[model samples]
Target: MREEFGSGAAGGAAAGAGERGPVVVALSGGADSLALAAAAAYVGERDGFAAAAVVVDHGLQAGSDRVAERAASQARGLGLEPVLVRRVAVRESSEAGGPEAAARDARYAALARAAREIGAAVILTAHTRDDQAEQVLLGIARGSGARSLSGVPPRRELGDGLVVLRPFVRADPSITRAVTEAACREAGLDAWRDPQNADPAFARARVRASVLPLLERELGPGVAAALARTADLAREDAEAFDAMVAEQIEEIVEHAEAGIAVSVAALAANPAALRHRIIRRVAEAEFGRELSREHTLAIAALVTHWRGQGPVEVPGITVSRAGGRIEFARRTGSPRRRRGCADGDRAEGGGARGVAGTPEAMEE
Candidate 1:
């Protein structure tokens, strides 16, 4: 366990903590989080760095405050300093993506606030291999592309100079939920189990309770590990593709009047995968919208199969071809026009006017 904790990004952060703020563990009193707290406390002491814990109470369940307090107490017992407990209100309706996703957003926001208050540079989350497997399976069920299948990354920047790290999830041996529970038991800690984990109303709960088990039973075991491995490989590919897009996007993209424009010739020059990614990347980076696979392909068709197709209206943006460039503008902005051509130049001979639906698109 020490070897596992003393490796990876968490280990590197701990080694360099002398010049930075303390490392914080996100504690929920669950088995995985409890085990993480224990490992962090021990490793921090041995490595001469400050370790702390933050417990976030969503207040979704009755007695959630008590649960938070118990977790805080456990953190204190583990010799962690300045344990903090935060209670956050989850706004389900206002937040996009379902209740679970909304709750998660709120929880992470609270965690980020806590980190800021304490001057913490790194926040450790105890998402195990099981969680990774579940995320990949969920991505597959949604027919998502490589990005979604990549699952949660090992580390992501939460704020300026602050990052959230999942040590157990990306561990070489891949710590499992059962392993965390055993660790908690060995340490004489009574871990709290969230009932929502097994509730049927949630997609993740259904995947954990039914889908994964069925796959493991029929496939003769190791299915979960394989899924987690798949996430690692997918993440590598996604990262490489993202880097390539970053390198070429500025060269191909240009700001138009009240909109953005891409070189149609440039887009057509790339392969389908790269072309689609570039289209989605434009919408995401400029307009804060995620384009679905169907939407991306539809937008791609304007460049690849151009027979003077009209503007393709996706959520929040309208994509259209004008001469040698593809224009993207806000849906509510001025109507798109073909450059160097007459005003309102519709598709030649009225080619198919592509209008994408509003359904959330799969990520690439």
Candidate 2:
């Protein structure tokens, strides 16, 4: 791992404290996460803090409970004191889309629930540099602007009473795996690997096994590192842009029955880039889903080409033009929003790809 990249090496970075509650570590039985749980233990030991591990079994496949149980045992061995493992039923709700996204959402919800139960401040996840880079790529492929390109945040507010932290966003997954392997060897334990990683049924799998490897071979050995660095830079810039947008929203956003309504007239007056960002921002708040380019364009069309009182529905949400402004609200407004345009939890997957900082000592 590069020294310039903080938190790249095992147990290398200092603890970041900000709006932290009951620290809940999300352990997925993957090397990236196992190492994170162990690191949390180390941090807890050093900081006089007692941490708990939360493992969510999504029931996506058979033998999942066995995996979750193994993760709980590992967390206990790592000195988490009492690791709490729970299995959540993945219903085919908007929140839990397919097997992959459903599992992720359920896991996060379980962690948040546990955090609330314990009054924890921060929920830590082991989203590595590689993951961040892949996210950036996904975001780019989806044509999300700079905000989407920024990738994963190191720390940000999640649900109430909890701010998610990715201390290892700059860390190399290879390094995390190495650390986990070392721990496994020393403890005479087995580390679990997700078979889906090589299943090739998902976009991420293709990116990992084919696209990224090709990029690395054709571009250079440190292509993933470069992508991650780009994401870091993008993240910084995107955050700044979002801050500015928030300030602008105050001037143009009006409270409405749906949610926050945007002044289309005021929006038209802004710069083109700001216009697109504002569109994305408003959609983000309203639907909480990743609105695609087509969706944004449809909204923009109302400003440019629509006559009067025509209903426009985007995936997950609806936009109505009355007077001279655009209103963004959930389509169903059925109290519970379905994922799509209205369900923002799914988010924009391809926001940024995380690159590995450099895992240690690899054997062919």
Candidate 3:
């Protein structure tokens, strides 16, 4: 536990200007998060960085406010200054996968807000290797591509000059739980377990409770570690491809009247993977729509397998090719929806207001 805490304490201090402000921890009252808050507070005191904790009450279940208060109390006991408890509304939906994603997006937004209010440059989260493994398994099951397989990133810029850090992404959940419990005991703090985590209605809960255990039994030990390793390798591959795509995009795409255009010749010259991504990027940027893989391949066919196929209608937009260019424009008379995808995390548009982070790796 001490060693794990030391590892977190050593990693967060960045060089130069970004290290000047406070470091904020998103405390969810779980063992992982409680450990993170305690470690961050300890690191701040020893290393001369200001530290605070924010507890976001999702208000999804009964007595959520009490949970938040308990978490805030724990944070205060840990010597985290300016501990805050924020209440957030989690949007509900009958659509599959919508509710979970909405809660994740809302939690991140609240964390970002808390960081801004405290003038903090970095916000730390407590996602362990177990979480990463489950995320990877889910991504694989969905066939969402390597981006989804990459799982939660260790660090990401959340705009407003703030960065979110997942310090325990590489750490084992069991080790984190033990470490957090030890730290809480030492500090005389009690951690609260959210009942939702055990609810079978949630896909993640089922994955954690059943699917992973089955995999472990069938595949032997270290399955979770292997999955986390796979995510790291996939992330590296995705980053390289993203760099290549960024380099090729500007030369191949242009803004046209009431729509955005991409050169068919340039797209055809690239590999299918690159072309498919280009098509999706253009659609997402101009039309504010996330194209399904099938839709993306269909659009790429206009270049690779041109058969004079007419414009295809995607969620909020129409895609067509004319004069050696593929164009995406909003569908006429369509009502404007919120600027996010069905999954809720990926921003629909390319502008700054769009959600921060990478595009969704898979479509519904």
How accurate locally, in lDDT, is each candidate? 0.80, 0.67, 0.73
Lowest-sum lDDT 10-residue window in model 3 = 355-364
Clashes in model 3: which pairs? none
Task: Tell me the alpha-carbon RMSD of every candidate.
Answer: 5.5, 7.8, 6.3
So what's the TM-score on candidate 1?
0.89
Q: After aligning candidate 2 to the native by TM-score, how far in Å is the CA of 338 from where it should be?
A: 26
For every model shown, what is its TM-score relative to the native structure? 0.89, 0.76, 0.86
Let me know the TM-score candidate 2 reaches against the reference structure: 0.76
Deviation from native of the Cα of residue 92 in model 2, angstroms: 2.3
Cα deviation at 170, candidate 1, in Å, is 1.6
**CA displacement after TM-score superposition, residue 316 of candidate 1 (Å):** 1.1
Question: Can you list the residue pairs that collide in candidate 1?
Answer: 292-361
lDDT of 2 by residue, 1-364 (tens): 1222223432332343323433678888887677677777666666566677888888887999999999999888887755888889876553334456556666777888887887677777877777766767766665656665777777777756467777777554543334556654655556688898887777777777898779888988877677778888888887788888899988999888876688878878777667777888887775676556656676787877777735566556767787877887676632233445344432322222121111110000
lDDT-best of 2 and 3: 3
lDDT of 3 at 119: 85
The candidate with the higher lDDT, 1 or 3, is: 1
lDDT of 1 by residue, 283-341 (tens): 99999987767678889999888887678867678888988999998886434556643
Ranking by TM-score: 1, 3, 2
- What tens-digit string does per-residue lDDT give for candidate 3 at 77-154? 878899999898887553323666667778888888888888888888877777888889878866778788999887
